[model samples]
Target: MKTEIRFTHQSLVENSKSGDRTAQYQLYELYVDAMYNVSMRFLGVKEDAEDIVQESFVDAFRNLDKFKYESSFGAWLKRIVINKSINHLKVKRLPLAAMDDNEYHLTNEDEHEYQNIDAMDIMKVKSGIEKLPYGYKQIINLYLLEGFDHNEISDVLGITTSTSKSQYHRAKKKLVEIINTL
Candidate 1:
């Protein structure tokens, strides 16, 4: 038998489910910034991220009855924000996967410049990710930062699992190169 996992804020969820406006507002306040950050990571624009996060919260609240506590409310809300962000990108004709074999071409003038740098810190990594192209950045953000596996990424991006795996590997290689040059 399976059981629903209890959430830390179970009362808030339950109250919100029962049409309690105050509980809903509290839940929104708790998650808004985090969800906005998640959308920003994908969409990379302040206004778009804000809109996506707001829409995600509205959808989550309206469909509160479908949330069975199998996952934390934060986790469920995060998925909503991510999905909305990706859809926003798709509607705007943004790239989710690198085209062809673009990640394979290196622009270094000499082989001596390939020295590996190991002084990676959070700020450096964050800046490096920001410098990545849209496709590579999405893969890195999803697979590395967001902790999504290839299968989940494939499902989210509507691609095959092999494509997701390959894209993630290529994106990681590009990210490492960028970090080294930073």
Candidate 2:
């Protein structure tokens, strides 16, 4: 089922790359909702998410020629959307702090603290994440929800890998605290 969908999506992308207007519209329709949700997760504002999604689609179509099939087109488009969202956040002056590598250490107990987080209600967890400070929320969203590893996150957010790890840990701890309060 998934492979067939990918093949159809690939065909649509190829047509879009060739400047086929109908195919481009179809491709936009296919991805817009998911991309909007992703943008919403990052921005937490409907207006911002809507604007970013529109901008991201325009940018994706304009740059479609540069895309290779190395990864799925959706994944490629998603990267563009995420980057745009992050750029938007940066423009808002959201301070993503860099941590000194020697300042904090990760331990087994810290890992254990997060292990049971999955048992919480999804909506509750999401609410907890939303209450986090901007930097922690971004790290939690990128790592836990978007599945970006620390290295990729560091690259995207212009921080060190150690900072990413430390932030993620702090985010988790904060999220747990938030959940407990609720």
Candidate 3:
């Protein structure tokens, strides 16, 4: 028998907006683990990720009326989780290169060169992505992991579309360097 996929949070979110505390708590419980994983991907540190997760959920609950249900509840919560993660990182103030108009190029040709690599190789690439500098890692995670296009990333990161593209190029370049070193 196929196990049932529960949608407790999605249901609770609808009810929570109507001011149901129990439903709100259920929603919190249902999404907490997944949100924590999202935060972990960005923050990398356990305590910080947990803190962000808590804050995101609290914010989501408090602002429940703002949820229009355009996206899935998970997607909405994930956005909140990501925003909290970004804020957490901002508090750390990691050094980043200033935005420059000059672009760094990463071609489809380069990506294709690694397409035939094994799973271990793919994991290595992800590891390299994790090791990238703060700005590069954030851009890469938003673009690659979160599936945001350059236009959307520009809005989210408060940069130009060209800047988003440039950052991604630099991030990819740094990834390639890391992969080559391994």
Model 1: colliding residue pairs: none
Residue-wise C-alpha lDDT for candidate 3, range 9-34, written one tens digit per residue: 56778778888877877788778898
The TM-score leader among the candidates is 2
- In model 1, the Cα lDDT at residue 139 comes to 81
Worst 10 residues of 3 by lDDT: 113-122
Model 3: how far is 54 from its true place, Å? 0.4
Candidate 2: misplaced stretches above 4 Å? 1-7
TM-score of each: 0.84, 0.93, 0.84
Clashing pairs in 2: none
lDDT of 2 by residue, 1-182 (tens): 44333337878888888898878888988899999999998999999999999999999899988898888888988998899999999999987655676677889977888888999998899889889988898999899889999999999998889889988887788899999998
RMSD of each: 7.0, 3.8, 3.8
lDDT of 2 at 136: 91
Report, for all candidates in order, the number of backbone clashes. 0, 0, 0
